[model samples]
Target: MSTTTIRVRAPSEVDDARTGPATGRLRRRIADNLTAYGFLCAALVCFALFSWYPIIRGILLSFQQVNFVTAPEWVGWQNFATLFADPLFGVAWRNTLLFTGLALVVGFAIPFAVAIVLNELRHAKAYFRMVVYLPVMLPPVVVAILWKWFYDPGPGLFNSMLRAVGLPDLAWLDSTDTSMLSLVLVATWAAMGSATLIYLAALATIPGELYEAAELDGANLWQRLRHVTIPQTRFVLLVMLLMQIVATMQVFTEPYVMTGGGPEDSTVTVLLLLYRYAFTYNDFGTASAMSLLLFVFLGGFSALYLKLTKSGG
Candidate 1:
């Protein structure tokens, strides 16, 4: 056999070899953690400055009268009392509730129906989806302005169409009876696209086998939708319902832009009233109180909803 040779590494050399990569890896890991934490801290600081600060400041302002010219004056529950005494307060709240209810009924169902139709369509889906989502992509102010034009009592697009059909022109935005409903329709049209897309995504996630099984069992189209599709999308439906409620309850844009809280104040919403208090009336205290009330109501409602849904699940 050829002569065998063996080389022994020194203990120091062995230790250095063993520790070199480990040390480098440890340093890299520490650096990565530091970088990640730095980003997170930056995000926290931004949120603190913007969101938390605003919320805290509003709460404090709710108990104090602060006009830009004068120093803030502390008043205990006076702003709330003022709100209670104001007659328009009750009307604003009632109209806000009415808008939320009407928007929910119309805005909620139409999106789901549209999503279902889109999911079923096999031809030119991309084109149709673009059409549906076009409104959502447009700026809210532009949409409100465009619809305002459409709702014009004379020579408006809707009135023109009505006249073409030999029907009398309805006072869409002028009459109190139709004003809130008109706002609701505009809100629905503008906001429904996003909800429809979400429903479509949820529908797509549903397994196809269930539908095939339903068909084999002689279930009709409605039965398939009722049994297979609905149960599968129940979670999405509940979540969207809550979000829609919250969003509609805070509606201000359409009413402020189109109606200006008019038609006998029938279209006034909570946010529109809050805006008036802060800007028009120069009463920041009352505006803060209105905001606080809205926040509390929404927080409690959301908590209760989550609890109920958790238990049901």
Candidate 2:
């Protein structure tokens, strides 16, 4: 009787042991999936509200005239036609392209060089990185205002430094010749911080053995950097290039705050002109049209860049 009772209890105990952990694991997996889905749903909702909604609204507005005073009137392609007819439209595009080119030449290379230097340093890296990134921490408006003061013809820091060294002060923003380049400098200074940190992270990921192998093969610093470092980080470089181009093309803040598209509209940009249409001119349709064009352009450019990079890779 004792043996039979023990056998019956053993079977039930084994079943409980088998099911207990499996049930717990199933519950945990369900909980994890629920949490992941909750976060994803929230993200989708926010993008729908903020990003997608505005894009759809802008697309609609591009087809209709809205001044907030009258009922919106559908105008078909009138807005785009008007944009093309405007003289400043051409100037805005030209200046925007010029600025983008200058920024790519200046802004894209400096951060990489700075990152390499920082990575090679033996001491006080954190301090230098913070210093380099400090400009980016400040507000864009504040940065523009600060640089505006620095570029002031009468009492600017740059002029002061020039005078201290007995050199003549150039018309940094007042002259059309120097205005765009000056703005590029301001932008490059303000944006290089994050790029530098990203590059530092990329640099840190490179395996030590490859670099050691390069050294053993009698490769110098530049050789190793070209052959080892750059090849290893080609994907990163391509992505950063695309990002920089996109960002430079859409630049607005520094020019807005500093130049106000002045010095004979030498600093006018596409976005700045778009702002004028929306608020200054009260032609939301034209503004929307310009934004749509810009959006399509950036989208195409991004696609092309990614394709080319992928193929090259």
Candidate 3:
């Protein structure tokens, strides 16, 4: 059969035809990238100025003495040495650790348990959620002040209830023994809502079929929770646990407003101690050193937590 001869275009010609669109695409991509970077520059600059600069400056200040008046004088480890020598340093660490442990035991689990219960409810969920989160909506200062009134020895709600129940009126914040617990109570009331909501969200994501299968295997409520619920939500629980530790360790406002770290300095936390170093003692260098120490401790704790969780998972 006779066929018409077709002329093939030269490779160079074909490349030339393709080059224009390729160059256009490259230019367009460069332009898009430049536009994206231009948009990101403002956020980058703000983060650098506000966040990164403060962290670097704080570290530098830890090694230097400054009074917001004269030039900062570099003093090596003098600030850290002074902090270590301070009598309140050990007390602060002890109180902070105690608070963190108590908060973990009380504040951390309560939210998860509440979330589990709330998840099972078929009605009044909205009302219960609103009630649970109501305290969180109030200002922290207001909550502290409110709890201060609640913990008052005279005509306070707690004492009134105790008296009504024929129990002796107990000194809540006034006692060194109960001051930290009182603070933990208020913190739990104010903070547990967020964690509860987070847990509720995590619980919702769990497939119902898993529970059905678990039940089919003759698992009871506690068994199912231990085997399925906990393991499924283990990551979230661990994250919340670490977060509670960090927050409790840095406690300040409750003790500052309620007890002023009083009742024999029983409620003094690491952050409250840091505040004293900076303001009460007028020693910025030592405060910076303490802050750096706290940062390092929390960072190490977080790293350790991640490692443990990863290994467990």
Per-residue alpha-carbon lDDT of model 3 for 1-313, expressed as tens digits?
A: 9999999999966776788887767877999999999999999999999999999999999999977878899999999999899899999999999988888888888999999999999999999988888888999999999999998999889999999999998899999989999999999999988999999999999999999999999999999999999989988988888888888888899999999988998988899999988998888989999999999999999999899889988
Indicate whether candidate 1 or candidate 3 has the larger lDDT: 1
Q: For every model shown, what is its TM-score relative to the native structure?
A: 0.91, 0.89, 0.92
In order, candidate lDDTs are 0.93, 0.94, 0.92
Least well predicted 10-residue stretch by lDDT in candidate 1:
12-21
Q: Which model scores highest in TM-score? A: 3
Which candidate model has the greater TM-score, 1 or 2? 1
Candidate ranking under TM-score, highest first, comes to 3, 1, 2
Error of 1 at 46 (Å): 1.2
| Candidate closer to the true structure by TM-score (higher is better), 1 or 3 | 3
Better of 1 and 2 by lDDT: 2
Candidate 1 C-alpha lDDT tens digits along 1-313: 7998999999967876888977867877999999999989988999999999999999999999988789999997999998888888899889988998998888999999999999999999999999999899998889999999999988799999999999999999999999999999999999988999999999999999999999999999899989998899999999999999899989999999998999889888889999999999999999999999999999999999989998998
Q: For model 3, which pairs clash? A: none
Clashing pairs in 2: none
lDDT, model 2? 0.94
